[model samples]
Target chain A: MTPPPALPPLLDLTGIAVFALSGALLAAKMRQTIVSVVFFALVTGVGGGSVRDLLIDAPVFWVRDPWVAPVILMIAFITWFTPSRWWEGKMLDWADAVGLAVYSVLGTAKALAYGVAPVPAILMGVITGCVGGIIRDVLAGRPSILMRPELYVTAAALSATMCALGTLAGLPLFTVWAIAAVAGFCLRGAALIWNIELPAYSRDP
Target chain B: MTPPPALPPLLDLTGIAVFALSGALLAAKMRQTIVSVVFFALVTGVGGGSVRDLLIDAPVFWVRDPWVAPVILMIAFITWFTPSRWWEGKMLDWADAVGLAVYSVLGTAKALAYGVAPVPAILMGVITGCVGGIIRDVLAGRPSILMRPELYVTAAALSATMCALGTLAGLPLFTVWAIAAVAGFCLRGAALIWNIELPAYSRDP
Candidate 1:
């Protein structure tokens, strides 16, 4: 009858906030209205986790939590009122990397706690960490991030796989989660720093 | 425990097949590979119902049914192999209309059976019918059907509302479902025939 170990409140909020901000930033780039920005932020912030919750038959995390929606809306508002120039930097990419890493591990952990198989649980982690951005990009009428030759999903998969393996090996929760998240963050950081990309399918082929 | 009253197999298959075909048709229009066509077909066919199932905490519909995936794949294969000219015409529209109406009523009924409230259940119905197309359009990198001035989601809403109302009034399941679906079909059919559209938001105001 023990409760599952949860991600710290600050950490969870940081992940949600960063993702929400990224969504709003896309809206801003498109020069959409505030309403569209808010809508985008909400969807991108909640999309992945919502998909994961539904698949795992958990009551949707945001629907049950009071703070998540309001926090996303606040992030959207900030994105709206602030000058776009302030958001144009490598800082945004770094923040997004953190969110991806954290959410990936958390998603994998939650899926495992629900008794999902290891491989599917890892898939759940990727879904939780990345589906939101895909949803946002789609709504913005752009190519999905996944459609690009990027390390984004690969980073999430790495974190999820690490977490699943760590849990299976009966490692302590702190060690497992830290290593998983840091490993993902490091890989994503390298991609960003080095302008790395996966090879695209050759059109000639 | 008694089993839930299910939509007839033929009817369900017809809806799934038509939606899957529409999805594959879009892929073909984009000149994507057969694999992309099949992926699009499966996603568009199951997207809405999967969302409803997740929201209601029901085991995902397609995963449980052995027939659904293979049928969708067959539809995709047919679409990929056939000349696009064969799929051109009012027939595709007509089939889509049938799928929309049938899926909407079925979604509402399933939600109600699962103890969802009337308003949310009606929304679920609409989600079940239209979200597949939305997802398809998004993945295809086109404007969402919802963003257009057309009467698509509105038609779905009409059907869903009618179904909810009929159920609330204690009408027989068959009558309610038929009336609801026909109402939606007629509206959508009329839109298709007459090229009806809702007024777009004017920015000049």
Candidate 2:
């Protein structure tokens, strides 16, 4: 069988770095120890991809990757030394939006390459993009994004679904990937700008 | 290459039912709908073991087992119809302690059977006993047990360590399992009765 399609190495590292930064920043803001910051960064960097791999019966990516842990550690050190306020603006969110889009699309592509069905492959992508943040919030004893009727998870689902559909339509691989990434990034970026939120069930309108 | 030791089917079911009940009961107490209640039961019932299986590269148990889903669904139905007050006493805690101990031991045994090293195998057991509740609490927007300076994780760790040590010492599997479960349950039981908690770092006592 042909090897599964690979995510571009630079984009993959950017995703992990972006995620690690968010986790480390949270810990630093909370005045947690350097160890906690590092631990948080490590989990957030790898949590989503790890869970996706597990669900898809694939080898866990970070366990074998030499660079993943070091990248997370470096992120932690950066957070530990820097003022948390430096990360408290829209810049981090924008970077995270990009990471979410890229990872979700690529994760779906990888799952599809591994023979997963479209629906599950899309869910796999959603898991790959969103689970790390959920884990970080949980560990920090903060409200998880999943608990909010926000566009975050929706953005991930959008990217994953788009990738699955594009593949199903026999679109060119790189073109589909680019479109899916841009679509998700745009939605998430819009959410950050407008503070968009889905109405709670109680609102119904 | 002997097949990995099988947890007694009855005991396995009991552990799952107990965990499922805890999750369902939590959702029910919060006045969540039947759908949420059932979803909680499903996650709590299989969360720990699923993580363990994934980490060990074993096929996920519930994904293939027809019985597990049915049991969790049954638990959801039971919780939905029952008054939440009916489970308000310490009885549930006691039952959860048993489930924790039994599952932790069995999880470690299975991981060891998969040729996981001692330390990671022990951690597998703790993950099996604890992660379901963590996921449930996280999803519900509640402070998870991990944030508490409680004996819950400690009990799981003790049982897991005991199992690993016993196996290393060449003891009979059944005897080791029995001792590990009892040790863990007893510690957890004592914690409940005494309202025991570990000292926080600041307390340092």
Candidate number of the best TM-score: 2
Model 1 segments beyond 4 Å from truth? A1-3, A201-205, B4-46, B55-57, B61-134, B143-205
Which stretch of 10 consecutive residues in model 2 chain B shows the poorest summed lDDT? B196-205
Ten-residue region with minimum lDDT total, candidate 1 chain A: A196-205
Could you give the interface RMSD of candidate 1 in angstroms? 6.3
Tens-place lDDT per residue, model 2, B118-200, is 76677679889888888888899887766665688788888999999999999999999999989999998998999887643
Return the lDDT, model 1, position B108: 91
Candidate 2 C-alpha lDDT tens digits along A20-94: 887777666666655456657767778899899888878777644656656777888887776655666776677
Prediction 1 TM-score vs. true: 0.61
User: What lDDT would each prediction earn against the true structure?
Assistant: 0.84, 0.83
Cα error, candidate 1, residue B60 (Å): 3.1
Clashing residue pair totals per candidate (backbone < 3 A): 0, 0
